[model samples]
Target: MITVSACMIVKNEERVLARCLDSLKGLVDEIILVDTGSTDGTKEIAKKYNCKIYDFKWIDDFAAARNFSFSKAAMDYIFVADADEVIDEVNREKFLTLKQHLIPEIDIIQMMYANQLEFNTTYNFDKEYRPKLFKRLRQFTWTDPIHETVMLDPVVYDSEIEILHMPENNHAVRDFDIFQRLIQKGTAFSEKLISMYARELFIAGEDKDFLTAESFFTGLLEQEVSEEVIKLIQCILVRCGRIKNDSELILRYALKNIATGKASAEVCYEVGEYFYNKDNIKEAVIWYMNAAFETDAELNIHYNKELPLEKIALCYEKAGNTEEANNYREQAAALRESLM
Candidate 1:
């Protein structure tokens, strides 16, 4: 049987920390908790578990904190965990069995991270596979018969264990602050980070958040960028234009987005919102129809799903088309039900 070290980085997670630790108790051989400046009873709770605890200074970088926690792990494999996550009894047994029977050649283990849509964070899916466990040390091996080369890719295994994510509240506000800080510091964003930032904004950003991101996304338009990045930038600018009530900003990008011959649901929804706010119900419904049927969503799927459907239903009701309104409402309800 292989020993597993559960590692976590947390701050001010006093409310849910104990619950998470309780679920992890017998499954892992050891626990390593790295506290990033917690002024709460989080340390006291860690003491109850008799886990190895380390204090890490807040560096505005989660990777840094995670790496610190992983460094303290002394077991054969390190299991990355979060204070907002837990494993149920069924999955806990599965996890323990996997640990006992796992092959030594496997370097990474992926587990399903479930209950995502409840808080509707950056992800669109309710459950997805995420790398949760790792072999502490990797042994290099050569492959092929004649011209041998070292294997570069880690051997990965997908496990049946599912980790339930039960956060008390959405962390978008905290994530937005970090994104804004990085943007203001002129830090270059990788393609993945750019996509994640756009998704988080579309899912939970307020008017102020869009306004704050307006300048940065607009700057990207002036540079040479990928087509996908351009689409993301267009979506961001459209929301910013709508929030600022700038018709020129809206129409400019709306025209650019339309010229791409592949309009995005986000831009279409924003256009519908623009017309709706102006009381042009007919034009709004036309754009909303485009959002629902014509364009694919670039960010949040709800823009192409329930959001436009709900608005179309409202517009029809306002236009005295009660039958059509009911039809669209029913379609929206059915769509949501199917996803559930």
Candidate 2:
């Protein structure tokens, strides 16, 4: 059987830490918990689990803390876990079974991460595959009999084990703070990070959040970027303009994308919101229809799906068209149910 070391980086997670450890009992050979300055009873709970706990100084970088925790693992495989995650009895059995039968050649294991929409975070999918287990040591082998070359890619396996991500609260505020700090330090954002930041803003960001992020996204427009990244930045600026009630900023970005015939659903939705608030039901309905059918969403998927549909329903109601309003409302409700 392959020995698995569960590694976790935590801070002030005393409330949920015990529950998470209890769920992992017997499934992991050892637990490595790295605390990043926790003043609560979190360390006491880790002691109860006999975890190999180490203190890591907070560096405002999650990757750094996670790497520190992984370095302490001493098993054949390392399983990255979070204090908010729980594996039920059925999945626990499946995990143990996999640990017993997993081949040595497989270097990575992916598991389903469920309950994403609970807090309406950046992720669009409610359940998606995430790499959770890694081989502690890698083997380099040559393949291709003639003119053999070293294999560079790791062998990966997807498992049926589902881990429930049940966070006590939404962490968007904390994440936004980190992103802001990174931006202040002049760190260049990867495309993935840019997209995630835009999605988080659209999903859970408040007016203050949008206002604070406006200048950063606006500055990005002055730099040369990919077409897709430009579209995402445009969407962010349009939303920011609407929140700040700056008509010039909103129209400047919105018109440019519309003229290119590549307007994203988020831009269309923002335009619809602009008109909707002005008591222009007809114009709002047109824009909402464009959002739902004419354009694809660049960030939040809801902009192209449920959000526009619900708004269109409201627009029809404002126009005194009960039949059309009910139809659109039913469509929106059905779409929501399908996601569930």
Candidate 3:
């Protein structure tokens, strides 16, 4: 059996820390909890699990704190989790099975990070696979202070395990604040950071920031980026253009995204939205159908699935096809019910 150490960096997570730690019981050989100056009872909760808790000075860099937690691990594999995340019962069983059958040569294990599990009024169900499990001997380390990711070899294995993130505290502007601070400190932005920064500004809801975000996103497209990141950046740029009421720019980015050999659901949906805004129901329906029928899981965001269905229903309604409109609405309702 491969020994696994659960490593986490936490601060002021008293309410959720115990719940997260409880889910890891009997699943890992050890738990290393690094507290970054928590005034709450988070350390006391960690004591209940017999976790090796250590205090680390609060630094702006999250990777530094994570690396410090990893340094205390003595197991063959290191598993990272946040205080706001929990492994469900089914995924916990899968995790145990994965631990038993894990190969030594697998440098990293990609697991689903289910950002939203059930449908709520605030956010839709969002999820993606991330490399959360790593081999200790591989010397993998986390990168970036914000949106940190592990540096690992290409030999990765996908696992059925899922980590459900349930955030109780709302730190909506925290990441944007960090990005601003990094910028003020003269920190050179990486391609990934640039994409994320643009996204933050766009979501910040400032009227003037949308134009700035569009400029940054336009610059991002000129740089070499991975297909997935390119799709995400294009999605943001298209949205920004739409919000800015720049029809030509929106069409340009939307067409560019579609021409990427594999237009993602978001790209298709945005195109549908663009045509719909122009009162072209027929053309909008075609693109919305493309988004609705998209089979590539990685290419579809959570909203991509539901939004297309909803838009298609509206398009059919506008086209005076009552039966088709009702059918599409029923399908959308069923999908929403299933998610709930």
Candidate 4:
């Protein structure tokens, strides 16, 4: 079996560090903990896990910290983990088997970063996968600072290995604080940080930052040119309107998004819902029809609750399309049943 090195870079994570390392104690051959100036006993906990701890200065760049940690690994494969993540028994078994005979050609392993959770009997965000495992021999490097990404050669071996993220979010404390620092220092904002700062600004209900967020998001799109990012920009524009009730800006993005083919199902639905709520049935139907069968596979991002389908069904019923109305009515019932 090949040796697996579990590595991490953390600071002020005393509360969750032990639990994170404990979960992987059996799965990895060694643990490498890199502390970026932790005042807490984070390093002391690392010693308990027999981790080969290293010290790095607190640079605002997460990629720099992460890359420094990976450089110290003395194993064939390196598995990176956050202090907030834990591996379940099923995933542990899979990792052990994969380590035994990892293909030489494979540069990275894409594991499922499951983010689903429940609180007081309500289902929260759905889970998604990200490439987290690596072969240090391939010299794979991480890029960006905030939402850092691993740069690997083509054809990453897909592993069934999955991790459950029991996140202890101090978003207001840690994330925004970093953004505040970057802003105060006049650092030429990283694209990743721009996305994060925009999100945090939105969450804080800051209207002035809406325009700034729009510019940064659009700039990121121009630099990276991703459809997903464009859709997010549209989302911010829509939310800015909702929070401010500024119909002027809302109408601009709504129309612009429709033109660019970047509008989400939620966006179209919201536009439709706005008209529907205002008793403008015809306009609402046009928008809802566009949303219901959106071409963007990612556009249906968990907001198509029964109400949206039911609303569309009602719209169709009013438009005298009994067939479409009944079809949507059935869909609404099925969705409601599934949720129940």
TM per prediction: 0.97, 0.97, 0.70, 0.70
Candidate 4: stretches off by over 4 Å? 37-41, 116-128, 139-155, 170-173, 176-231, 269-300, 304-340
Report clash pairs, candidate 4. Answer: none
CA displacement after TM-score superposition, residue 285 of candidate 4 (Å) = 7.6
Q: Can you give the lDDT of residue 171 in candidate 4?
A: 40
Off by over 4 Å in 3: 1-3, 37-39, 57-60, 88-133, 138-164, 169-173, 183-212, 222-231, 258-264, 274-287, 293-304, 318-320, 334-340
* Per-residue lDDT of model 1, residues 64-172, tens digit only: 9998988898999999999999999999899989978999999999999998878878898888999999999999999999899999999999999999999999999
- When sorted by TM-score, best at the front, the candidate numbers are 1, 2, 3, 4
TM-score of 1: 0.97
RMSD of each: 1.1, 1.2, 7.4, 7.6
Better of 1 and 3 by TM-score: 1
In model 4, what is the error at residue 284, expressed in angstroms?
Answer: 6.4
TM-score result, candidate 4? 0.70
Kindly indicate the candidate among 2 and 4 with the higher TM-score. Answer: 2
User: Over all chains combined, what TM-score does candidate 3 have?
Assistant: 0.70
Task: Give stretches of model 2 more than 4 Å off.
Answer: none
CA shift of 21, model 3, Å: 1.7
Task: Give the alpha carbon lDDT tens digit for every residue of 200-261 in model 3.
Answer: 44334355555544555566567777777777777777777766667887788778877877
Off by over 4 Å in 1: none
